[model samples]
Target: MFEGVDLEVPAGGLLVAHGPAGCGRTSLLLALAGRMRLSGGAIRVGGYVLPAAGRRVRATVAVARAAPAVALEGRLRVKEVMAERRLTGAGVTERRIREAFETVGIAPRGSDLVEDLGPLQALLLATALALAERPGALVVDDVDEGLPPDAHGSVWQALDRVRNSGPGPTVLAGCVRTPPPASGLVALSLPRRSLDRLPAETAAAREDTAT
Candidate 1:
């Protein structure tokens, strides 16, 4: 659990929660997304109340989990997924969806089967869908998962490109490890564990400083 944790990200800013596994990074994202309740605290995200006003918040907030949620249905073509989303409820156009794909530097043909994409391409497609939603806030969990160091840099660059564009939403991501120095990301050096242990460690450090 976290205590006295304060986080602030300006509109369209990128907030990266970097920590080891089990450090409550994903939990914090859930809380901010209103999927989980905050025990006691005020939360204002995308102009909606958190924990309490979850449904309302969800409208303007979109979340894309790790590859587990990146399934694109093998039989359907790449653009078909985008079509399905628009048919269901998204008011976004094909051009807009294509633009999202372009923004991430992925160009899957409309007729391409979902199964054809490699792991990274699949991930990019999932991200493109999230961007298509055009939510006020976007949260992506486990960005660094399953990526080697070489590809990690490229992925971060792509994510950053999307994070700093026109009508950009507030972007938040959680990373378990790697990407040694997470520069250009707000809150990049998040601790590896819960803040429950922080106060005592901080106090001891202060005592040593005082001595």
Candidate 2:
């Protein structure tokens, strides 16, 4: 559990929730996406208040790579995954699927199995699926997970492209490692898990000072 965490990212910008393992970054992202409930405090996404308007917030936010709710099955083919999502009412079009692959700089054959994809490729696929929904905001967790230090740059770059893609939805990502500086990048670091119960205002103040 965490509290007093606050942030405001402009449309089309990227916000990285930076922290170490078990620091609640993933939970934070999940809550922001309206997939998890908040025990206290408040969240306002676009013009909608969370919990009170959670259904609308869930409809407005697309979450990828957060697990349980949004995960790509390795046994599925790329095309099969796209087809399933469309059938489930993600509203992703054939044209948008192709554009999402291009947006993330991948060219996977529709026949390729998700299990055969490289780390960055898998991430791109998850991201592509989320983008296909065309939500007002997109949340992705573990931006640098499983990627080598050298390849971290590539992952961030792809996300940057996603941020700039058509309509440019606000992008929020969770990362164990802080990202290098980039245009429109906002890094918000969380305190240690031991401080999880710290007063809300104090946490917000710490965030401001650290950033």
Superposed model 1: Cα runs more than 4 Å off: 1-4, 66-77, 111-116, 178-184, 188-211
Instruction: Please give, for residues 1-211, the per-residue lDDT of candidate 2 as tens digits.
Output: 6666666777677888888887878787777787887676667777776668889778878887886567899999998988987876466787887888888888888899998988888988989888877777788998887888889988888889887876767788988887889888878888776534422421110011000
User: What is the Cα-based lDDT of residue 1 in candidate 2?
Assistant: 60
- Top candidate on lDDT is 2
Return the TM-score for candidate 1, rounded to 2 decimals.
0.77
TM-score of each: 0.77, 0.89
lDDT of 1 by residue, 30-147 (tens): 6666666566665666455555677876666667653343335768888788788677535667777788788888988888887777667766777777777776667787887776
lDDT computed for candidate 2: 0.76
Model 1 clashes, total count: 0
10 residues in a row with least lDDT, candidate 2: 202-211
Steric clash pairs (candidate 1) = none
lDDT at position 37, candidate 2: 75
Candidate 2: pairs in clash: none
